[model samples]
Target: MKFCYACGSPLIMKDLEHEGEVAYCEQCRQYRFPIYHSAVSMVVLNPNEDKILMIQQYGKKDNILVAGYINQKESAEEALKREMKEEIGRSILKQRFMRSEYFPKTNTLIWNFAVVIDSEDLSQVSDWEVDKAQWFSFEEAITQVKPDSLAQRFLNNFLQEYKIKSKDFFA
Candidate 1:
């Protein structure tokens, strides 16, 4: 931060134990850390784990994973589950935490999860925020989401790790 949020003073780099150099305000006599928002992303899947769901939102051409910001007093899992029901009209029946990524452009830290929802209630997938939603095979899902994006990275990590773990679990 160029200026301190607490006291509107000029901030300089100051050595801090364990934290190294941080933005320190002489007037406030404290360190200032840049604030970033935290959000949750979900790799929606069906019960059998054979399909992955992707959504197109905000009139965007690319298919992206379902995600939303974590509200105050809500946990990351709660945020993901809420996003699941809000975006796709399905309650998450099962979920597993996957990974987190920081997007500097949006100043957002995203916690990703692999969520399983009942496919019996999947036909009517329309929310005001979501333009379109579709289910794809594991291979197709890996190809459908926007390339080189956080959505793609999260989906890839979950699917790759699931494969390894499934093999071990079965063995």
Candidate 2:
């Protein structure tokens, strides 16, 4: 940040004894404010129980789940629904909490949910934020996308939980 919000003075990067790395303002005698980003993502599953719906990013073309940033006055659930409609043009039937991960270094928090949708047809999908939508099997999805990405991590966790639940149901 160029100017301090509290006193409107210029900010400078300085090594702080207690805080380690910080932006300090000489006039305000305080550290610069930090910014945080909040995002929502959904792991949309079809009714077949064999495949998961994913989007091929327009710019990246990487296999990723439906996701987007939360707007100024929108809730996480609202953001997820809006993103789904904007990206894929489908209505989500139900959404269940999956997990949340925070990247302190990047100041980003990703809230993930597992959503149940009607089908995997992508003919009506929108090409706004996403280029196309496709269904990928659990094994294929893990092998195709970046291993360290939030989408992959969520998929892995979901698969484990799904398998356990299935086994319990059968037993």
RMSD of each: 2.3, 4.6
Error of 2 at 91 (Å): 0.8
Reference-based lDDT, residue 125, model 1? 66
Give each model a TM-score.
Answer: 0.90, 0.75
Encode model 1's per-residue lDDT on 2-29: one tens digit a residue. Answer: 8888888899999999999999999978
**List of clashing residue pairs for candidate 2:** none
lDDT for each candidate structure: 0.84, 0.79
Q: Model 1: clashing residue pairs? A: none
Q: What is the lDDT of residue 53 in candidate 1?
A: 87
After superposition, candidate 2 runs with Cα above 4 Å error: 1-34, 104-106, 166-171
- What shift in Å separates residue 149 of candidate 1 from its native position after superposition? 0.6
Tens-digit per-residue lDDT, 14-90, candidate 2: 88887787989999788885767888988887766678888877678688888888898989999988888888778
Q: How accurate is candidate 1 locally (lDDT)?
A: 0.84
